[model samples]
Target chain A: MPTVRINDENVTFNEGATVVDAVAQTTGRELTAEGKPADGGRLGVAVALAEEVVPRSRWAGVELSEGDQLEIVTAVQGG
Target chain B: MADMSLPPLQIGGYSLESRLIMGTGGITDLAALEAALVQSGTTLTTVAMRRYSPETKTSVFSMLERLGIDVLPNTAGCYTVRDTLLTAELAREALETDLIKVEVIADEHTLLPDVIETLEATEQLAERGFTPLVYTTDDPAAARRLESAGAAAVMPLGSPIGTGLGILNPHNIELICSRASVPVVLDAGIGTASEAAAAIELGCDAVLVASAVTRAQDPTAMAEGMRLAVEAGFHSARAGRIPKRQHALASSPMEGRIDLT
Candidate 1:
């Protein structure tokens, strides 16, 4: 089992969890068939692991360990 | 409808006929915002990133999608290269676009770009193969450096953001335009129609407007004004103006002037 911090929320998951498993636990959202952090319309959310972006392609394969830091962001209004 | 006859404004792989790139901010009404988008005839516009909030949050993303308008996601409040990089990465994953408007500010009071961080972010973004439209100061030398760093566009403020002060340093804008190989964008400090014209005439490839239009009491009319102003500015630039003189060189020939004058 690994304890990872996502967007400042510390989430613990079953042992031998990948980055995908951590994201599901952290955001509590369902993954699409293509296996991305998305909800129907895709909030345009981006995820970063350890300050480096975890590309969507590699999300399923990259495993997470204890204390790994994650950041999730989405598009908002601005000038 | 935007006139398609104008010479296209090209940035990276995108080419837009309209030189006005509007910002989706200030105005709270969604319908009115859509109306303003159409009125402005802007091919590209900006949106900022925020932490996701689901319960009370409705998607402006859907509204933009319905309008079929392309979005240029921005890092509006990022204070450092690290924050900006993450924000930009999020925007890309969420928006599925490479277009980013990089705004790395030093503080909220000034809302101005931090020169050192802006430069650093631009170089890194380019290295990562993302197209960055950097918001930089009006320093021509810095503008050159940003271009060298592979910025898709160099957007320099005419003054501070939202001040409506117009172009406080026209010469610097002109100087930046004169040297830049990439498009020079006049961003922020635009208060009215003429300033937009001046920015275009000074050789800016495009103008990014927000408060001057979206916040106007008459936003719809203001939006139209911006559209026409951008075209007029581009036209005037192409038409070419006579050199400024200390004394008037009479438009009417000397011989045509009345002797009584």
Candidate 2:
């Protein structure tokens, strides 16, 4: 098992895990290949890997690496 | 009487009927924020992007969605152009809107916008097809440059962020508004409803208030007051104020005082 940092938390996952798998494991919501929620609800989330934002369309192809720093952000109350 | 004299504040493809843009920063309770937001009569509101937490229960995005208010996501805490662009991209992805409030702060103490980086970010964001509403200082020249950089709107700060010191330089604000081709929105340092009105009276198309209403003792009351004040200011500006005179000019006719003579 390899560990990756997501939202400052270390998560262990098997090798060959895609970004979508990482997101699904962390958020508990499955995403379609198009990066939408499997249930057709609004996902309302975005992911940045190693300081570079990964587009939703590429989430399925981008595989996670060991010690990769991931940032998953959403809208919050602020100006 | 409600004043419906001015046209809607148009930016990019969006037309906002209300000129008051409420900010959600510093709000303690979501229910309270919703009440104030409804009372404010604002068609647009601001939200910021942060790391997602599963344990967090309150969803401000869902609340704004239910209230039918358009969310204007901001790059609030970004200090560099890179950070600003990244935050803005995230905002657009998560929120699914191209409207981004481009705020490139200088430092922590003052939290003033870094105009140099801000200008660069605005140009880049605009090039990326995002409607960048840039937040800059109350500098007329800077405002002009931002508008030239393809900003959808230029938000000039009244003083500093969350200081509540009110507009420190009305002359600069008026200058920015006078020459701006795009919409001019007074962004920060508003303490009360009067300041919100003052922004409009100074020729701003709209005003963005956060700490004033969200941190007030009674947020709902202040929100209502802000709504009324903005309306009053719009009408007063259009009504044409009388010129200032050095000497007293009595409204009563002097011809009626024959007995004193």
Candidate 3:
């Protein structure tokens, strides 16, 4: 099992799991490699792993490592 | 003059139809925020990035999409260059736009922009192919440095964020607007529609309002008022106001007043 910190919460994933896997599990929305919802809807989400922004195209290729810190963010009401 | 129209605001690669840029903050109700957005007639609106929560649905992005308003992602709560850059990167990815509002605050107490960090962030973001709209203090020198640092637009605060105190230093704002090569957007502390108008009158290219409209008692009405005010302000700015003097000038014919004597 690979343990990772996602949005400040610890979560253990199966071996060879990737960033998309974590996002799909946490958001409950199956996402494409482009990070769009598989249902052809706008996801409006972005991911940062270890404080480095991970582009949507590389979400699946970047495997989760032990103690990996991930941040998934979306739009909120702000100035 | 009756058929005159205000020119569109050109910032970076976008040509904004409205000079009043609305901020979608402090409005808890999504429906109300939508209404305000529509009523404001703003071609662009700003949104902040935060952690995603499944329980709390975010229709903000979808709503903006439906309304056809371009999103300007901001680094609102970031206090350092590292955090600001990360936030900006996330915003660029999430929003799929190169437009970023570089807001590096010094502290939470005053919510004033850290000019040094903001300058650094602007330089880096611009280098990364992002159109950085740097929010800064109403200091002419700082504004000039940010412009030189590759900011697409310079947004100088009239007062602290969320204060609604209005433009405290009109002279400084005027100076910044006059000297800047890029667009000058009056960012914070606009309390009413008049202040939005005042910004344009003071040579500001645009005005960004958040708390003034979002936290108003009647958000929709205030938004509409702001729309009208911005238009009026634009026209007034070009209309050329009368010069100030210690002595009052009579509007009526001075020669026709002899009958009263």
Candidate 4:
């Protein structure tokens, strides 16, 4: 089991876990997990791993390694 | 009439026709951006990556290219060196240009560049052969350091990114100009034509703005005003200023004058 660090918080994942999956599991917030209220539903999440922007669709295919830093950014609307 | 010769300014090996560098964001559309660019007479325009849709190639790049203007791609939303570098690489590939507008923002509220991360990204980009146009704060020392680190130009913010507060620190901007060997372009917080003019008058080589022109009531008209303001600022800078005098000098012969009855 390889460990991953996201924004300095450490999390464990099974072998061959994608960066997106690891983030969703660690945060308890569904990235692709949809169907909630408009204000409370998960809008979208953008992942930046090792300083490269990985598109949402490609996040599932991206293989993660130990010591890889990831940034999971979610968008929120404001007036 | 007087001689109208002015020295030319070079940036990233390109001879700029004007010191006003426009941004491609916040416009109604590509047509409006083109019109504004034409009216401003700026050779370079900043384009952000986040605004681009990867799904569709329909973008302002082709439009700006058709207008015969140079594109300076910006890393507007990047907060780290790695993100900035990646964005720069992507921009280079997409735009087919090595010129980059590097913005490492630590705080979204202030839109201020993270000096440490910005310098780090700058060093990496410079090593990798990217001409980084850094958007920094109005700090003279930081501007000098950026120039020393191989920045194509130092773009200090007049205030925040879109507040249009104008030049909050003219003295610091002047200091940056006096210290740096590269061009000093005022990057943000410019709300009107006068702010652009003031930046140029403070010895900045150029002004990079978006909302001021694109979000105005009439984009084309505001663009024209910005053009004239930049021109006026350039002329004023070249014309120099009247030296301040501490004591008054007698215009007439006051010491030898006779009293009248």
Candidate 5:
């Protein structure tokens, strides 16, 4: 089992799981059983793992490794 | 009723009721973007196209259409004339609009527009019957050249994109606004409502901003602030400012009637 850190929270995952799956599991998001975020998850926010922006759809293909930093940035509208 | 006598801003014969322009890149979600757009009271919205994805179909475009916003597709990542032209053509076909936000960057690090390439692409796009809104630097000479080349509007970056440093050079922006015949929009590098207001106060025709509102702690509130800032800036500009003098004013009655002395 390989472990990854998301926003400083450590979570262990199966070897081949993508970063998205890891987040879905850790955050108890609906990606595991239910396909989507119920109403098209938060916008303007992106998940950056290893300094590269990972599209929402590509979360499945992105494999995780030990000590990878996953950052989730959500949009907050202000002037 | 509040004074509603503000004249509509004309760009290529299109009268935009609102002076604020929103960028589609930084919204938390399409839904949020929609909410902010409504709150901002802006009719024009900008979207960028580079690496086309089939999956993006029906979601992004459809949502924008549902909001009834006029889309201004941009050549955000193009660095050359060929790519810019192709992207503009594709955007026209896909977005069904002849309006293009032309941004030709020479360096990815700073995201500064390549002046020569930008002019070349602008000339071509204008000749092709597309309304070109060129994003450029705050050089008066460059802005004048773009105007002569027939740019519909000239957008000068307040600073680098997404840094939110606000207006770095107010004098240069003022220079551009004063010299250009076309609409002058202060684009990029705006971090807050104050920055937007400052640009408008400097007599810019409009302000195009994204990350400031979309990346804020509360996007909807920030959008409203931006709206107010533009209005305030416009009003301030119209009201005219008093001249600043280096010497102190003689208000203390040096020789005048001072009964309490």
Candidate 6:
């Protein structure tokens, strides 16, 4: 099991789990719609892996590794 | 004079006809927000970036897109340069726009922009090809620093965020506007239509308001007021206001006095 950090929370994933899986395990939220994985974060969510921002299109291609840091961001209300 | 066109408010590469920019925070009602956004005629509005929450049903971005208004993501709650930069990067990626409002706040109570962190974040964001609209104090020197660091615009606070104090330091805001080569948007602390108008009359390129309309009893009416005030302010700035005088000068000519005749 490879240990990874999603936005600073340490978690272990099965071998070869991608970035989207790590996000779901850590945040208990999906980047995609419940039934729709094709449309990822149409609601303006962003992710950065190890401090380097990765767009939604590349989420599935980027696999998680040991000690990988993932930062998740979404749009919320503010002044 | 009535039909005179107001000068466009230009920031970065985008030129907006409306001198009013809105913030989406503090407005809980989506329908009301839609009405306010429409009535305000704001081309660029602010949205804050946070972690995705499945519980939250309303999406401000969807509303913005439906209305055809441009979204300007903000680093509103960030306190450190690193956090601000990260949030800004995420915002740029999420929004798919280079435009960002850099707000490195001091504390929870005041919510004022931290000068050092703001400048640092602005520089890093600018280097990354982002157009940062920096929020800073009314200090003219601070505004100059951000502009020198490649900020698209210098947004000086009229007072604290959401305080509605309305231009606490007119001279300071004026000084900032005078020295600023980029657009000087009077951000935050606007109480009503007059404050928005007054900010523009003080030479601000535009005025950013959120609570004044969002929290108002009738948000729709307040939004309309802000829109009209912005237009009025633009025209008043161009119409050439009379110089201030210690004593009142009679509108009627002295020669028109019947006793003198």
TM-score of every model versus the real structure: 0.86, 0.94, 0.96, 0.72, 0.72, 0.88
Note the Cα lDDT for every prediction shown.
0.83, 0.90, 0.92, 0.76, 0.78, 0.83
Better of 3 and 6 by TM-score: 3
Question: Distance from true position, residue B236, model 1, in Å?
Answer: 0.7
Which structure among the candidates has the greatest lDDT? 3
Fnat of candidate 5: 0.00
Q: DockQ of each model against the real complex?
A: 0.51, 0.68, 0.80, 0.05, 0.03, 0.49
Tens-digit lDDT track for model 3 on B119-177?
Answer: 99999999999999899999999999999999999999989999999999999999998
Candidate 5: tens digits of C-alpha lDDT, residues B1-261: 777555778888567778899887766476787888889988888877533222342355556667777777888878999878877775665455788889999988998999899999999999999999999998889999998887999999999899999989999999999988999999999999999999999979999988988888888899999999999999989999989999988767567565775
Cα lDDT, model 1, residue B20? 88
Q: Higher-DockQ candidate among 4 and 6? A: 6
- Say what the RMSD of model 2 is: 2.1
Kindly give the stretch of ten consecutive residues in candidate 5 chain A with the minimal lDDT sum: A70-79
- What is the alpha-carbon lDDT of model 2 when measured against the actual structure? 0.90
Ranking by TM-score: 3, 2, 6, 1, 5, 4
Candidate 6 residue pairs that clash: none
**For all candidates listed, what's the TM-score of chain B alone?**
0.93, 0.96, 0.96, 0.89, 0.92, 0.94
Which window of 10 residues has the lowest lDDT sum in candidate 6 chain B? B50-59
What residue pairs are clashing in model 2? Answer: none
Interface RMSD of each: 2.3, 1.7, 1.0, 9.9, 11.4, 2.5
CA-based DockQ, model 6: 0.49
Q: How accurate is candidate 4 locally (lDDT)?
A: 0.76
Candidate 3 regions with alpha-carbon error over 4 angstroms? B254-261
Residue-wise lDDT of candidate 5 within A1-79, one digit each (tens)?
Answer: 7787775777788888786676466445556322245556422224666645565667777788888887643211222
